[model samples]
Target: MCGFWRRYFFLKTLRGLRVLAYSPVTRPTIVPFDDFVLQEMMYAYKHPDTIKTDDEWIRWIFRLRRRERRHALEFVEGWSGTRIAIAGTTPWLASCLVGIIWSAARGNIQTAFTVAGFILTSSTVILAVLAIISSVESSNRAVT
Candidate 1:
């Protein structure tokens, strides 16, 4: 009787699994940007001839409303300086950790400190570059 019940339960579980495997996956619909500046950017991206020069692109963004200008600046920063800084520094940071670990494991405390200091100095330089980029971006926004 117990063996028969086990077979029955197994068949029920298999049928349930088969039903789940055949079910269609439902993905969330991705909605496009509704903002005027973002929509214009999309159109310009699709039709490159619309804005021909860097000056034209800058001027176009400068002409937008204050909120729109801020949004455009943020979007540009996300794709450019800020993104580059984080992506470039992340690997250096990971390597810094590994170097510190390796040196400490080898009982070379001084070497570990040296490696940490050098990487940290480079990180500071990268941070300075990021600061300059952000300041320039802010100045551009201020000019309009």
Candidate 2:
């Protein structure tokens, strides 16, 4: 519950700041996380232009990796809407499932059914919205 609220408010803050301005019509290219780390390390360690005799090697490597991650995240901001929606709803869904199970264990079939119906309805709505967003984004990209 705490995590959900934190994430929700964090996203809300970002939206308020308009920090998520760029919305690509397609998902950004995904570089595997480990691969990106390894590549960044190699570039930082072996690239003569960045090598130094000081103890700043760790700082340099972290700075370079952070910058790359920032760019990747920026490029992937278009998927944030769907991602945020799913993330925000996941905890509620899980809790509902738990509640339904508990109700069934107590032989409250009616309660279980009611919760199940709500879950099904909410899930359908969420999925439909995601589908519509995906189709619209794809069509927009095609038009451009």
Candidate 3:
């Protein structure tokens, strides 16, 4: 209610004045959102579901009052699909790595061995990380 109603009811305002003891909060003038935030809002609008990420689960724990839960499990499901698609194209990366390693093999045996070891370790580590990402995304889909 406005100040007049507040005075009529002897609320937090002064005894007989148009003064408000508390001032209203000012609205923020600007909001900045990244791609992730926009994608998440779109996911909620398109395919609502429980966002079952670990961080989101923690948020649910500290919620003050029960509000609507917009289920957006498709968010993670689509992410898993994208990860699988990326993993499927990993052969391209593998071929490039192999070419580099092959070129590195023109030197002495010890040099070739060390270079080969490093390239294989690094490239395979990338692939391994992709696999782990795929697995985690898939699990998130299942949980959500």
Candidate 4:
């Protein structure tokens, strides 16, 4: 009898917590997946440089092989750095999103407010470094 009463009281307390935590709000607006996909496809197709025909793909493949040969001959080619910048940005964006969600769940207004700013700052710094490196490389090529 004592064990059963203890368990019942614990469950009742948990039920009260659920009631206290209840948030009654209207449903959030959701974007239709089809419409979102359509928008992305349209945007990608609208870019002339990104749109590829079969012949264009073949030509691009050949061009890539030619560039590879040239790089081998030169032996001075270096990293593109775009991938590095993108890598840095990817984690920052993911962290910012997670932080936002965490702060929302915990109701931490300060954390939610500052997380995005910090992420943006790091992203900007990474992009700036990548841009400076690329620009220096381009300038060196022009000088040589």
lDDT of each: 0.51, 0.51, 0.45, 0.48
Q: Candidate 4's residue-wise lDDT over 65-142, tens digit each? A: 532132111112334355555555675777678677868798986887577677777767765775576557545764
Candidate 4 lDDT for residue 33: 35
* Per-residue accuracy of model 3 over 14-71 as CA lDDT, tens digit each: 1111111212343212223466755655554444465656476357434522343222
Top TM-score hit:
1
Which 10 successive residues of model 1 have the least lDDT summed? 14-23
Q: Per-residue CA lDDT of candidate 2, range 1-144, in tens?
A: 236633443332222101121224544344345655555555654464775666676564355364223322322213356565775577577657866796869888677767776776776676567557655654565452
| Candidate rank order under TM-score | 1, 4, 2, 3
Task: Let me know the TM-score candidate 4 reaches against the reference structure.
Answer: 0.34
* Each model's total of backbone clashes: 0, 0, 4, 0
- Cα lDDT of candidate 2 equals 0.51
Pairs in clash, predicted candidate 1: none
Superior by lDDT: candidate 1 or candidate 3 = 1
Candidate 2 regions with alpha-carbon error over 4 angstroms: 1-100
In model 3, the runs with Cα more than 4 Å from the true position are 1-107
